[model samples]
Target: MIKILAVGDVIGRPGRQALQVGLAKVRESMTPDFIIVNGENSAGGFGITRKIFDDFINSCGVDCVTMGNHWMDKRDIYEFRDHPQIVLPANMSNVDDPAKGLRILESKSGVRVAVMNLLGKVFMKGENSCPFAMVDKMLDLTPSYVKVRLLDVHAEATSEKQGLGQYLAGRLSAVYGTHSHVPTADERILKNHTGFVTDLGMTGPYDSVIGIDPDSAVRRLRTGEKRNFEPAKNDLWFYGMLFEINEDSGACTGVHRLRFPAKDS
Candidate 1:
């Protein structure tokens, strides 16, 4: 079985620090064969920067970096959007470039893995295409030799994410949810072939509202106040999923949730 560690969205500076601390602890113990992180909000809680992306791969030992709706918030992403390690949303209606949506990379164990990203349209601002159709097309285009497929469906609705996971149960090795910073309790193996989770959660300040300052979030949510937002500083945590996949058949044999700073650790 090949172990893959999939992390949730990194919020901001606090998240980066948590990543540094949590990753070191997990790497020393769990020692995942491959690692993928959702970093759409790594840059000041909006979008990822080129430096942060490189740091995630070079310093953090992350194999793949997935994106979400806020991916374009940094604006500098175009400088390195074509990088092999980075992936953007495939079905984003506003995106004219379609190159980074899907990528096939060789893991540390020399296994080729297909990684894809898609955006959800429900309650989201953009008018993106149907994720089901787009993913089906993307899967068809992927070379048959490459198994162990993974997807980061950065979406809003739980129903939509679960529906997509159920739809692609036997076809893909794993289907995970992101975008929503809060983690869900529902995580299981779908059809005994795929590892699925509603949301891996955010690797940032858990004491606040979805990684942001609670006061700011309250103002924005309750009063529709417009102001600059700030990332929370306390209670940093890293949330993710670990999957053990049968390399030959591309079936997930076992799955585990990873939360750093365990009591035993």
Candidate 2:
């Protein structure tokens, strides 16, 4: 079996710290062959810095990282088309942007795994391409050696994620949603052995509003003020998923959630 860990969105410093603190234990307990994390919000709850991206892979034990709509929040990433650890959002127009959406990694056991990053058209801020068509093109681009396919479907609409999962049920090994900080209750293997979920939640402070300081978030909600944001340092929690894959066929055998309970006294 080839086990793979798929982590949810990382929001700011709190998320990074939570992953840093708990990932080693997760790796030891699960013994996964590969680890993937979504780092769209890894920097300051908006976009990732190159250093934070590197830290995600080096210190957090992540094999590959995906992004969401906030992938372009940092102006520095305007030239980040060549970053090694990131799988750029696929739905973004390639006519002007210098980023691509898919990547393939070879596990130590020789299993060729394909990870795809895609943005949805519902409730997203930026202009996006046709997800269905892009996914079709991605399927065609997969080399023969690739046995497993995983998708990080970054979207806000649960209907969209569910529809996509149904569409690609028998073809892809797994499909997961990101962007939402709260995880969905649905985590299970499809009839065709494909794993699916609405969202993977987040790795960050559990006590705050999506990893921000509670006072600031509440103030923003109540008074509509944009105060200087800081990642909440207290009461951390980590969220993600783990999958057991068939080594030969690359189909998922089992799927489970990886949750680090909130530290509250």
Against the true structure, what is every candidate's RMSD? 1.9, 2.3
Clashing pairs in 2: none
TM-score of each: 0.96, 0.92
Candidate 1 lDDT over residue span 1-265, tens digit each: 7899999999898899888788888888877888999999999999998889989999989999999999889978989888998888989986634456889998899998889999988988878989998888889878888879999999999999999999999999999999999999788999999899999999989888999998888899998995768788888888999999988899998889988642113
Q: Against the true structure, whose lDDT is highest?
A: 1
lDDT of 2: 0.81
What TM-score quantifies how close candidate 2 is to the native fold? Answer: 0.92
- Model 1 regions lying over 4 Å from their true place: 96-99, 261-265
Clashing pairs in model 1, backbone N/Cα/C closer than 3 A: none
